[model samples]
Target chain A: MKWDFTSVFANTDALLAGAAGTLRIFAICLVLGLSLGLVVGLGRYARTWWFYLPATAFVEFFRNTPVLVQILWFYFALPMLLPFEISPLMAASLGISLNSAAFSAEIYRAGIQSIDRGQWDGARALGMRWAQAMRRIVLPQAIKRMLPALTNRAIEIFKMTTLASAVAYVELLQQGKLIASLNYNPIEAYTAVAVIFLVFLWPLVQFTYVLERRLKRDE
Target chain B: MAYQWDFTPVLANAPLLAQGLLNTLKVTGTSLVFGLALGLALALLRLSSRRTFAWPAGLVIEVFRTTPPLVQLFWFFFALPLLVGIEMTAFMAAVVTFSIQSAAFFAEVFRGGIVSIERGQWDGARAIGMNHGQALRRIVLPQAVKRMIPAFMERAIELMKTTTLVATISYADLLFAANEIAQKTFRPLETFTVAALIYFVVIFAFSLVARQFERRLAVSGESTVR
Candidate 1:
């Protein structure tokens, strides 16, 4: 019938607070997920059973299950096994970070695998150790190729930050829920939230496209 | 005290969990079918020469792809009914949100697959006295669809995982069932673990099958679209 956004705009402070929560979790998960992914990715790429098998299992389990389930498990179920309770932020971050790690591990492994054996041979000829070769030679080139995919993963992590709301983690969507119910402006409130996300993510999505195209051309 | 793990309560509610699994499959299957069809249509429209057709399709794909599925689900479930003056069921909202959300992803896969087909195929079809639609249906799509299988299977697996969101909207999906059993039995640790395992088994099987297909495709020397 009628459209109104005043209710949404009036709650700018609440939305701003929500945005901070969303960003905090996003930053936490992004850093933890990607860094841990590199380790797990190396493990997956390893020939040793001790390294590979557990990495493989972790990737499969986390990748196969829905993230919401993981968050809920950490929030509700895990406390029973531990001496203390898990906070909403901690549980959500753990679930999202682990899930992102599993997904990104594959990306990292692929990127690492894409490097030619000659590079390794060259590194060996230069008297470099395995870690030295990986750090100095292989990963530098591999990261260039992995840029688009990794950026895409970053965008995914940003979108997934909303799932923190499922645990009442005070993220954007959770705040939108509060706004909608309090103001009885579900349409305006939800629409505002969606627009805010689109605003936040559209540029990142476009950047990925640009990176993909550039990578395509350079390769 | 070390918590003693028990599965008896979770095991006793097997039927409920089974029903939830069925519902999960139902949503995944329904959404997959619709998403594929809508995605193809969107892809075709996006590839059209006319700006009118292409622009709108691009908008839909970009908007849906950019937004979080959970937000989309909430909008459909809570906001849409009031906007349109209709009673919306949780299942209807879940299906609608997931279908269009997945369709956005599928559209790109379709577009990529279609474009990956060389220009010569279209020229050859046109030379054979085939119109655009017939050429696409008989020649282009068959070949493109083959390259798309791996990507399609991957998206389908993602869709199944995403269907868990319906539990949030009060749909009795597997994750929701886990919640109910956990609350009823106060064995959340066991209940959630089992639920996670059930999801893993089903989704992992699909992943394995998809990998098998990918291997066979590779053996056939057919390069696939992402």
Candidate 2:
């Protein structure tokens, strides 16, 4: 009937555990995603049909499909086909990693593409191979150019980690749902949950904004 | 030891799925229209000069835009009725959550477009003795809308994609339907793959149409293509 924080934050300890779980996934997924993205992204740009086309399709499939569906398919359906029954937690983590990789691939691609055309020419003109130039001259600049977008992407992916709850993972939203179901205080529970997300997300948001401005001035 | 592709089970339910597809379009289309209208209002208000006018609207846009719409939808469907002591249907909850989400995004897109205009145009419009609303309407807004078409399409595609999240709450859009069918059929790979294909088709079509619109809207008397 009225607002109640008593039940949701009935204690700070439980909320801390929930918030910690969120950060763990957020950090783990970012690492997994960025690593996978770097490899797949480089392969996509390598222009080898043996790899590029499949990598491109992989990127598109993950990027375009809803992350929630991907998580569902991985958790519910993937094990049925695999030789072994995979755990849901593994599936959730891997699915999030895979989906984020798809998006990160694009970020990588854009970062690579943003490199000056002349940089490529200059490297080719010298003794450096295509890979060498990309590594030496281009990627460094591209990396700098891309930090803002990458931070922004990371912020979004962190926000998106909430979707992991749909597969029954006990992220912030699900914790709130559980608390609400128990105490029957949906607003305070959700508000607490939303505030947790906001607290987590706000610093990243401000950092990205400041980072973007800083990078622009550097240009 | 293999997840062989199977479409027969899903295809068997095509007629049923087709109805669901129609429902998905209904939610996406209806929300797009109403949300854009509300978003335009938010954008205009955000752009308004008065301190009293812009701050509240800005705060709303910031809050809604930053948070996940699913959480917002949860608040709306479950919390709002309880808080306000009146229940809205699931469909109403979905529509309101989505419209509110779209309005935030549209405000940003529209605001960006408005800000992109040159200072000289504003001076000229105001110099002509036109009121603020008239200058904005007759001179500034038309050009801004045209500039914003590309963004509108991009936002439309994003909003449509986001509609799938509605299923996270109890709304039976395409993803929810797929979840139901998959659970019954136990055809996760099949149903969801097919679901992905259907989404790709809709988004692809929307993108094509949006691109066509962008090309059409490109001024014929344009200066050198920059």
Clashes of each: 0, 0
Q: Interface RMSD in Å per candidate, to 1 decimal?
A: 0.6, 1.7
Interface DockQ per candidate: 0.91, 0.59
Per-residue lDDT for A28 in model 1? 99
lDDT of 1 by residue, B1-226 (tens): 9899999999999999999999999999999999999999999999999999999999999999999999999999999999999999989999999999999999999999999999999999999999999999999999999999999999999999999999988999999999999999999999999999999999999999999999999999999999
Please, what is the TM-score per model?
A: 0.99, 0.92
Q: Each model: TM-score of chain B?
A: 0.99, 0.89
Runs of candidate 1 exceeding 4 Å displacement: none
Report lDDT (Cα) of residue B142, candidate 2.
Answer: 79
Tens-digit lDDT track of model 1 for A1-219: 699999899999999999999999999999999999999999999999999999999999899999999999999999998999899999999999999999999999999999999999999999999999999999999999999999999999999999899899998999999999999999989999999999999999999999999999999
How does each model score on lDDT? 0.96, 0.80
TM-score, chain B, model 1, is 0.99
